[model samples]
Target: MKQLILAEKPSVAKDLSRVLGANQKHKNYYEGPKVIVTWALGHLLGLKMPEDLNKEWQTWKMETLPMIPKQIGIKPLPKTGHQLKAIKQLAQRKDVSEAVIATDAGREGELVARWILEWVRFDKPAKRLWISSQTDKAIKAGFANLQPAKAYDNLYQSAIARSKADWLVGLNVTRALTVKYQDNLSAGRVQTPTLALVRQQERKIETFRPQTYYVISLEVGEERGKRVQANPYEIKDQQTAQGIVQQLGNGRVDSIVEKAKTESAPLPYDLTEIQREANQRFNFSAKKTLSLVQSLYETHKIVTYPRTDSKYLTQDMKATMRERLQAVADFSPEVKTYIKNGAVVQQKAVFNDAKVSDHHALLPTEQKANYAKLTSDEQRIYNLIVSRFLMLFAAPHKKVQQKVTVKFGKEQFIFTQNKIVEAGWKTSEEQRASTIQWQEGMTVAPNFSIKKELTSPPKPLNEGTLLGKMEKFSLGTPATRAEIIEKLIKSELMERTPAGLQVSPKGKQLLELVNPSLVSPDLTEKWEKQLEAIAKGQFSSKAFLQQIEEDTKQLVKEVKQSEQKYQDFSLTQKKCPECGEFLREKNTRDGKIYVCSSAECSYRRRKDPKLSNHRCPQCHKKMEIIEGKNGAFFRCKFDGITEKLPTKNEKKKKMTKQEERRLMKKYSQEEPQESPLAAALKAAMEKQ
Candidate 1:
């Protein structure tokens, strides 16, 4: 029987088709003598929304919130309904007795395929095609050793449990908070925790106390080179730094302790590691870098998977290394030259079969990349992956150490330097260009030594270093880390200052208003551990989900009981005319708006006035409905008035007949709140 192959994405489908002799391609379909392959557009099926559960839940009502259904339902989105139809049709084909799952070999990938099969009611026995890279050799080898689908039941279970739990907790809690707070606010278990992290950083910076620290440096001479300044770690206290410098008295030699140490070559670049380094060196946000890498992988087809977490390859990948390197080397001439030596560098750090999970670290696909077709950004990202791939097969960089000791006053000081012996495994030209070198067991003589005093505080956390911190805490996976950071900035929980991310006052207020446990990184780490356990079959998904449900309930109860007042950032003095309630103007993803104090009354006015033609006569511009402590009023166009008649701009210049007609036509076609740019600009100019 011909096998029906399901791939997670079009790119994977294309690669698999080429290797399976299924070169006869159709629109969204590929076929061969023995196999018919198709693909998934990420997810063709997803959990039903709150409105899908019941019509009553559509409106935001406090009584209708916390709508946890007995069983979460799944359905295809209307936009992609046909894709689901195609999948089901293929599943029931008479010639297709069994199927192969060639989706991404990860937790989410497992879920993607399983959900489709379940939805289509496919009862046929199934096989799995698990391979990290999409090279012809890897695909052939995977086909040669296909495993029964039953082998990954635990993985599917874990994925399902995660989806169900998210549905139960995220939807229910998000609805509950929106209704209870009488605002359009929403939250999820993962999202809330992520927000809390950003808010915490903001709080730290806002309340930070700057204290001067110290660092000691010296103008030291190399044996054969001129003098240069060396930078070392800072000492926090000025007093302590001064004492150390004074102890040095006149120039004196310091003792150096130098020992030979070999750093194993770094494992191949995983998505997270690459994102971190890119963020550090290029000042690229994690999200931007991921986008760039994704473009190279999908559009240019130069790099391997960009969403992978693994940093090492399985044993089977070794056979295909030469071909993969050849393709990358061809695009980057430097890489091509290194591999021409006919020597492959193999290090445990880069190719530990034991450490590899579903997918390996990102690498170049065996398909040669067409450099001229790539954009400059794509080339930069592609080059990064290419250089990283070439370095894996070069020798480990070796270095020598030198040490010298000198006594200055009661304190005995020491100095050391390192010299590179060889740049192994990373001998490519790019590698050499990026590498930093130092000599070991080396120190300056008395005449060359000088005492310097320094003081500085700890450096603020930047995107690069903060990413490293998040990695250590296992805050989120490589695929999700960038998104978390992006959300924080977009939501205004954290602001990027000159130094680094600073928590905003609004962020601090949110933490105080919500449960502390909801925002803790420990919660995320604990959940990740449990998810991994579920994936491994070591833990039960049911039990894990039960824990999430319990956590959600506790969080809701705490928020309800807490009496702490939220510091409303939109501190306006205007009152609502409808109910004489306090008016609050708030910013949203799109723009800002004014809402009434009563949560039950969904009275909201958009900040944009282009949609509405209403205008303030005083300013002769559209006036947005704003709430403050003052009584309900349409503030003046040029100056705000309390519950009084509208006014116009004092500086309003006389308009020509044509201008007047154009203005009239524009107002007739719009709403007072729909034209934000015009209203805001006119308001500012009129005020001046």
Candidate 2:
């Protein structure tokens, strides 16, 4: 009898099939004499939508909410209906004896496989094939030692509770706010609190007033300098700072305190830390980092799971650290050097069973990577994971930290120095030592100047800083935090600027209209804590869900009764021809656009010029297609050049950008051309 193996994605299924010797490949599954493997496209089914459960709850009406369902169930997702049907057929086949769940080893992955098994009515005994990495060794071992499906029942229960809770709270309150405000205002347990964080920063910046301050600086070296005062002076004390600078003369070191310090290497990456680092270094969005790392985990099969929250390894995993180091030794010279130094895992701080859950820290597989096949971004992400892994075995960074109190006239100035004792794990570049030196009771004269500064406002939340905040407040799980932040951006609640993420005009209004409790992180953090408790089997899923229902009721009621106004700053004078409704103006990356004010109407037009394929005669670049009272015509914005568009009967020459550039360069190089009349006159004058 064949064992049916189900995986989370096609790529993962292929990896499992190779190890299981499933040579026979079909459209949806791979078959061997003993086993058949199939995969789910992420999730084959999700919790049933309200519209699916009842027709009365379909329309967006305030009265229908809080549309709490008496019973929450699952339905096949529309896009993956075919895959779900295939899994059903395979499960029912007489040749198939037992099914093995090989989806991701997380709560969401458990839910993906369980929902399908329940929906398909697979009655055969089932086991779970859980492993962290997609490498061949991991797959082979996982298949050989399968766990009973019943073991993850609590985790599956937690997944259900979390999904249903989000549905109950997110859908009910979102509909209530949208219907009451007559605008597309999205609110949820996680996203609303996240948006509140952004608006909080924006408000802080708006009300903040800059204050002028002064400080005294003493130059010691050609380029090195030290601040003379421990605290900055107020604007009223500017003269006091200047007078102190003028009194600066001979300096005496009153004392010197030195302490030896050892710095251990950083812990392995959890998804949130890596995402934050990627955003800060590469300006990559949180979602972008997740996608890149996911490819490294799944497609390349070089890294362990990328969605883990733990930055530590269990006792069992310590034996494999050396092999993992060997796999990545070729990627960097430092890794080889580490191996040569006996590869001792000095920092025992990284190995703690209590700190690891769902999966151990993100780690490299025991297989070497083929760098040529990886994309540029993939290489970057791989380097980040590998570098962190190698550092775990590196020696502790040692240094001598010294503090010196320098006396300048009657005031005391502080100077500090950190001398590197051992360059372990860190380079001189990262751990720069102060070049300034002074001995006890030594005297030296230095030039001092008053430097003017100002008290700055709070910096805006970039993606990195925002992710850190989300983690601190337990806004969402590491896997879900990036998605929640992305949802805010896509919904037009926040925008990413060069400065950082700023709330849009509509987002500010939505924050004010939503329930105050909904905007605060405490509510979401409490829900997350209870969700974790449910996963640990300490709390009942039913009890947690019931709490969510009552909270939803309160949030919806507050939104319904809110007297706050929502002004459409985007309202336009022009009317939509399709629905006869006034258009609303919005600024997009392309430029300004006018969309129908009514939500039901899907009509929009670009207020700015749209580029056309008709190239300019001189630049050979595409011209803008402008709509006029008479008809449509092409206008070149660069040179203010206009050209008549060809009529229906007239044919215009069309060429690709490459062809246009090639032809323009080839012909335009022949030099200036004379008109026909001028050419004829020149020829006649030559004859005379």
Candidate 3:
């Protein structure tokens, strides 16, 4: 009898088929003598929506809310029903005596396969194929030692509990708020708290008042002409700052102290760390970084799983470090030197089994990466991962910190300097610090000055800082944090600007309307702790879910009873053509739009004016095409130049080849006089 193998994705299934010698491709699966392989497109089943369970739940009403069902049913995703049917048929085949789960090796992966099996009612002996990398060697080894599916029963229970809790809390709270407020606002157990973080920062920024402050500094020198500056003394009052500066005029160095310091290499990249670094260095959003890393893992097969939270490798991975290092060396010449010189050290900081979770830290696989095949963004992410991995095997960075104290009258001023003693693993140009020399107890004349500055407000939260905050708060798992940030942006609750994530007016209002329990990160942290316990078989899913159901009911009750009001700030005078409802102005990352305020209305219109190819005569920038009651016109913001847009039949006449040749020759001979339109056309042709 053949064993049916179910994979998480088609690419993975294809790899399994090749390694298992199941080369016979059927409609939706591969077949061979010993095994047959089929795949799921991520997840083919999800918890049924409230409306799907009963007809009464269709309408948005607070009375029907806290719609907790005794049994949350799972249904095949409508779009992927065909693939589900195919897998079901294969699982129940007469010749198939057993099934194998070959999905991703994590909590979510377990859910993907178990949900499908439950939906299909495929009762058979089942085993699991768990492996980190998709390399053929790993796959073959995994198949040689398959574990019973029962081994991950706790993991599956945890996954199911998470889904059910999200549905109960997210859907119920969202419905309650939408019905009570008469607007479509969303809230989730995890996402709401994440949004509250941004809102919290917004509150801080709005209430902050800048104050002027001053600092007095003294410059002193030691013997051998080595100079060191004293630390600035902060003064809140201008008069005091000026007095201190006057008192410290021409100060002399009284003492010098030096301390040696060593900084170990940074730990390897976990999903969050890499996402944060990518955001900081390339301005790539957290979601974008996750996508690039996932591609490198699944498509290129050069990196390990991307959703891991651990930053340390397993003890077993030490055996393969040399092979992994060789692959990294192929990408970087400096890494090649480290390999050649045998500089790779097995530091305990990077190799600890106890710290690892479902998967070890992200690492370069033994697969040799073809740099040419990677996109520019992928190359950047890959470089970051490889560099961090290589740094694990290098020496610690060493430096000396020197502080000089100067005495003028009764007050003392200090200057600090840091000098690098060894580059170590911090070999990058940006990591090096300048060196300074100074001797102890040497006296020299010093300059003094008062520097005035304004007390700054807290900087806005970028993707990196936001992720860091979420991590600190235990807001969401590394796998789901990026998606949470994206949902807030998509709902128009937050916006990404050059200044960083700014909470929208709607977002602030939503927070005010939400229950304090729902917006606190402490709630998510509590849920996560319980979920971890559930995964380890120490906590009961039933009890955890029961508490969530009670909490969800309480949240709905609070929303229904609150006298607080929410104004639809997005509402506009313009009406939706289809629904006759007042349109609301909404800002999206792409541009602005006017969407109907009514939840039942599915109408939206673009609000941004179209840009024409015509260039401005003054600034050479494209002009905007604005449509008014009178007619369409081209206006240039650069110079406020407005011109009537040409009619469809009044297109510019195409120049003949002879005319073009004459123009090119004329321009080549002398600077040619041309209109902005003519110059734009010429530039476009040259680009071609």
Candidate 4:
């Protein structure tokens, strides 16, 4: 009987098919005498929305929101319905005796396959073909020692819980906010926390006060007849600094304490760390770096998994170190020599099983990379991965760190120096050429310290350090972090300022309007802790999901009753000449025209300039073919001018500063009115 194997992606399925000798490829299945391989395009079936259960739920009404289904249902996307059909047919085939799950050996991967199985009514005994790499040896061994599918029940449970929880919170909160605000403002667990962070930074930057401080520098002369200028690291108050400078007068040699300290090499690169470094060095966005890494994995086949959190390898993978090292032998000669001379030392710090999860940090695979095939950006990324891989097996880079402290009465001044002691891993020609080193113990200054007073606000957030914080601290998974950042930007809740993502003025105002506890990282962290518990088989997925549904219900009720106002700062600009009210622009089949702000006024005018046939240079105001000193001059009502201007290669661009200020003012004055459902809910809330 044929054994069917299911994988996460088509690329992975192809890899498994090759290793299993299932070369006869059909529409969606690869067949051999003893094996048939197929794949799932990630998740084929997912939790259904409230609208799927009933059509009436589509509209954003308070009564219909906070939808919590009794039995969480799953439905296939129309685009992937064919894939589901294939899976069902494969499962029911009489020739198939048993099935094998060859998808990724992770929680999400397990969920993907399991969900499809349940949806297709697959009942055959299943085995798991878990392997980290796509190498022939790894695949062969994985099949040879396939494990029981029951082993990953806990992981599957955790995955389902995560999916359901996100669905519940995301849908309920998004619908509630949209209904309450009467706009398309959406919210999610991750999105809210992310929005809060940006808004907090913006508020801080807006309210930050700049202070002016003074510093005094002394130019001291050395014993070698050389004058060296040094600044005292200590920045004291202006009064004290002035007094100290007066005491020295011209130049005085202060005691110089120069001591040498050693510095060790940095740890190997993790996915997040690499992303951060690439962002800083190349100015590539986090999402862009991930996309490049995905290509390196799926297309080039030169790197391992790119979505991993682990920076170290497991002990079991140590045997394949030689092959992995050999893949980049030509690229890094120094690493080749070390592997050739002796088996590369397996440092526990770099190769510990406890730190490793389903996959290790991104490293070179056995596949030899064709550098010519890589784009300029890919080449840069691949080179970094190669260099980092080689650096791991090589010796640690050594350096000397120097710290000098000088005492001025009760206060002390400090200076630090980083001196390279030995370029161990960095000794290789390529590494040495690429690396930068500072000189050792060369006191080339005045050797005297000056007192200075300085004060500055917090620095802006960069993509690099922010990503590092997100990944290193388990703030969110790699997949979700990029999505959340994008959501914040799209929602106009967070804007890109000189310093990282700061909440837009409107974003801060919204936070104050919404429930205080709703927009917090604590919500995500709490859910994560529960998900982890479910993964460890210590908590129930059902219990966690129930909590989410109940909390969402209460949150919706609270928001529906609140008297706070929501202001959408998106507006138009046209003054009403009759009533002096700001004109709101509305689009009709005829064209764009201005209408009175008060809908009851019913005052409107034709805004089509083409109808008048004359374009004004000042404001594009159409004129009725007016005769002037220049024979035919266009008149502009807005600019109140009639002048000749160039028409070739000219376009009017909106001035953003004035537009934003105008919108903010308009929004601040007008408060949103609640929907009828919200009004009814408020009455019910009051009675309760």
Candidate 5:
């Protein structure tokens, strides 16, 4: 009898099958002399929806707002039922002796395999192959050193508790809000608090008024001389600022203080840090960054797992640092500096067993990337992970900081400069460091200038800053934070604007109507800490789930009892053709769409033009097909360039009646025999 291996996705199954010599391919699995490999399409089973538990919950009503079922069963996803059946068949095969969980090595990955094993009633012993990367060597090593599936039971339990908590709170309150408000509204433990953060910033911007202020600074020395900057203080009034600038004279150096400082290289990325960096550098959304890294990890096998919270590696990983660095050195030769004696330099900040759990920081695997095959985006993300890995072995940056204090009449100004000692991980900072000529009791001329400025309003939170806030509060795990932010946008409760993330009018109203506790991060933070405790087996899942149920019940009751009202600020003046009700404009990932305000009316259409394959010459993105006054044209939204679509058989433009009349009136002034142009125009007009 042969052992069976269950993988998370078909592509991964194929990889496992190839390495394990399971070459005999079947409709849903691959078989060999020793083992059989089958695959799951992401998740073949998910928790039952509220309606699936209770028939009464199918209808949206306040009476059934808190629908808590005794057993939240698992059901086959509608689209993946066939795959689930395939896995079941393989599990029961006579030739299969035991099973291996070869899915992703994470909390959710554990749930994916466990749900299937339990559902199929596979009685055989099971083992789990846990590896961070999908490289051939890693896969082989993982199979050789398999762990008992029982080792991950706590992780699976934690996944279940988290899932059920979200369902309990998300569903109960979402149903209550939608039914009470008479509109499709959404609220969640994570998304609601995130939306509130954005709204908080908006309120600050709205209430802020610019106030004029002045700053007094002095520029020492003249052009072509040893120029240094000395900033003294800020003045509230224009006259005061001018007086300070006008009374400036020769000054004597008061004192100087200098010290040596050093900064270690930044730690390698966890999932959130990389997402933040990609968002800031490429302007890519957090979701986009996650997907890119996921592809790099799964498809390319160039990076480790994409979802992690640790910024450190286990002590065991120290031995592999050289190999990881060597892989990265191929792309970035600068990494060569850190490799010596066939190993990377050891650093204390990088390896700590206590700091690593679940998985280590996102890292580049020993497998080198095939640069030609990677897209530009994939290359960018891979580089980020690799460069950070190289930085770990880099020496700490050392420098000496000097502070000079000068007394100019009644004012004292201080100047600081950095002198580079040894440029380590970051060379960019060294360029700003220079030796300033200053000492005690030295005399120098002082010149001052006053500048008027206005107090600026607070900047809105972008996806990067928003992710930072979410991470700070433990609002969601690295795996789910992007989805939470995306859900807010899809629900029409948040929008991405040039200024950054902003709450839409609908979102603002939803916040006012939602329970105040739901909008605060404190509640979610408490729940998240409890979830972490549950994962570690310190807190009982039953107890944590009980707390969640009680909290969810209270939140639903608060939403139902609130006297606040919700208005659909998204409604447009345009009326729907099918129903007399007004249509609402919704911003979707696919672009804007118009929908009938009346839910009963099934009328919807795309508001933006359909996209075509023809790329814009300027931006290289797919252009929209728009029907202009003459004919259809390809319009690039980013480039704002339009070009006419090529026609089948080139045809002359037909003269309009207005244009023909104007042309004939001007050219037909007893000049039918005057020129050939007049004759042509007369002939065209006659034909029309």
Candidate 6:
């Protein structure tokens, strides 16, 4: 009898199949004598929609909302029905005696596989395969010690509860707001709170008032002729600052004191921390950073799991420290010298069992990296992980921190300097400190000056700062934070600018419309705490879901009762053909479209420029086809050129079948002639 194995995606399935010796490939699975392997394309099934649960919930009416189903059901996604059918058939085959759930080892991964098992009704006993990396050795070891499927029941229950809660709250509140406001608006347990955070930052920027301040500085020299600068105090009044500067014609060094200090290396990257750093250093979006790291984990097999929250390694992984160090040292010769000199030390800061969760911090795996295969962004991220890992084994940076006080006619000024004692783990040139010398009681008269400045407002929220705020408030899980940001952008509530993320007018309006409880991050934090407990088997999923159901009812009622009005900012002058109502301009992923303002009317028209495969003769770029009072024409935005399309009567002179065949044969044999019309037709056919 064969043991069937299921994975979360085709890439992972291929890895498992290679390790399991499943050589024979079927249409949707790989089979060997003893095991058959198949995979899911992420989630093949999702929770049933509200309309699917009850026919009455089909229309967007306020009365139909708060539609909670007693038993939430699941259905296979329409697009992936074929793959689901193959998995179902494979599970029920007479030769298959048992199943192995080899999807990702996280809650979402467990849900992906278990939902399929439920929909397929696979009765056979099942086991779970949990592994952190996609390395062949890890896969082999994982398969050798698979755990009983029942062990992860709590995790699956937690996932189910989270999904159902999101559905109940997200769908109900979204519908209520849309129905009451007569505009397309959405709210969620996590996304709304995140948006509120952005709006909060924007409010600060809007209300901020800048104040002018002044500082008096004195430059004093030591016995060795070395100079030191000091800004002793800040004066809020410009007149006071000028008075002090004038009284102090010059400054003399009064005293010098020195103290030694050491700074430990920063902890390794958690998913959120890495996302923040990537955004700050590379200007990469949170989603882009997540995608790059995920590829490094699953595709390159060079890094450990990417969607982890822990910043330290578990104690058990301590045994592999030397091997991991060696792997990282292979990339840099300086790192190699450090390792060769026995610099790798077992530090508690790097390894602690208590801090680790389902996965450890992001680290370079023991696998040797092939830098050539990685993209530029991947190379940068890999270097960051490896650098952090190397620092864990190196010594702390040491320096001498010095503070000097100088006096100018009763007023005192202070100057601070840092002298590096040792480079230690800080190998970067910027971190290296230069030396400054000073002697106690050595004094010399020096220059004085007054500087004027204004207090600046808090900077706008960028993807990095926004992620930091989310992490601070426990707003969302590391796995879901990037997606929340993307959702806000897609909903047109937030926009990206060089300054940072800015709240649109509609976003401010959303905050005004949403209830305080719904917009507070505390709500999400409390739910996450409960979700964690449920995963640990300390809480009940049923009870948590019941709470969500009650919360949804109250939330919908508050939205319905809101006396606030919504202004249609997107309204256009165009009138709907079906109903005499003003049309509103809406931007979709494909392009912009104008829809009727009347909720009852379904009239909509595309307003974006129509893209055609016609090539422009001047710039060799695609031209846009436009319709005007003069009939059809092609316009090239690149070169500001326009050409009228041939009239139908003028275009009636067509080529014979033999001539067409001859032209096709000539084009196939060589590159097409570079004529305006011919090139356009060639580009169009190539697109087809």
**Best-matching candidate per lDDT:** 2
lDDT of 5 at 37: 94
lDDT string, candidate 6, 110-223, tens digits? 999999999999999999998878888788888999999999999999999989989998999889888888788888998898999988988898899988877665644422
Off by over 4 Å in 1: 10-33, 54-68, 213-258, 330-341, 423-463, 487-506, 570-688
Please provide, for model 2 over 575-674, each residue's C-alpha lDDT reduced to its tens digit, 9 standing for 90 to 100. 9999999998876778778899988899988898899888899888899988877988899998888998887557545555788899999998988889
**What TM-score goes with each of the models?**
0.75, 0.88, 0.84, 0.75, 0.85, 0.88
Tell me how many residue pairs clash in candidate 2: 0
- Candidate 4 per-residue lDDT, tens place, 544-630, comes to 988888888877787788887876554356677778776655445566666776645777665654235556666675754344446
Q: Over all chains combined, what TM-score does candidate 5 have?
A: 0.85
Backbone-clash count (model 4) = 9
Task: Summing lDDT over every window of 10 consecutive residues in candidate 6, give the lowest-scoring window.
Answer: 220-229
Residue 131 alpha-carbon offset, candidate 4, angstroms: 2.4
- When 2 and 3 are scored with TM-score, the better candidate is 2
Q: What's the lDDT for residue 680 in model 1?
A: 92
Runs of candidate 3 with Cα error greater than 4 angstroms are 221-234, 248-254, 340-346, 429-440, 576-581, 586-688
lDDT of 3 by residue, 1-688 (tens): 9999999999888889998999999889999889999999999999999999978899878778879898879888878999999998888789999999999999999999999999889999999988878877788889999999999999999999999999999999999998888888999999898988887887888899988767655543322222233433346788987765565545556778889998898888899999999998999999999999989988899999899999988877777887888877766666777777664564567878889878888988888899889999999999899888888877788888877776666777666766778877888624323243445555546465567888789888999999999999888889889999999999888889999999888888999999999999998889988998999999999999999988998999999889898998889899888889899997766579888888788887679887888888889899998876698889997799998887765755756578999999988999658999999999999999
Give the lDDT ranking, best first. Answer: 2, 5, 3, 6, 4, 1
Judge candidate 4 against the unseen true structure and give its global Cα lDDT, from 0 to 1: 0.71
Give the alpha carbon lDDT tens digit for every residue of 1-688 in model 5.
9999999999999999999999999989999999999998988888999888888988998998798889998999888888888888888889888999998888889999999999999999999999999999999999999999998888888999988988999888889988898788888888999999989988999999888877665565521121133432245689977776667779888889999998988888999999999999999999999999999998999999989999998988888878887787776656776675456654577788898888999999998889999999999998888878777777789988887777887677767777888888877774453445677999967666667878888999999999999999899999988999999888888989987998988899988998899999999999898888877888889998998889988998888778886677778899998778999888777889889989799888778798998889988999999865587788999979998886755424655578889988898786445588888999999999
CA lDDT of 217 in candidate 1?
48
Identify the superior model by TM-score, candidate 1 or candidate 2. Answer: 2
Q: What are the per-model C-alpha RMSD values against the true structure?
A: 12.5, 8.1, 9.8, 18.6, 11.4, 7.7
Residue ranges of candidate 6 with Cα displaced over 4 Å: 222-234, 246-255, 407-411, 429-437, 444-446, 616-621, 627-688
- Pairs of residues at least 3 apart in sequence or in different chains that clash in candidate 5: none
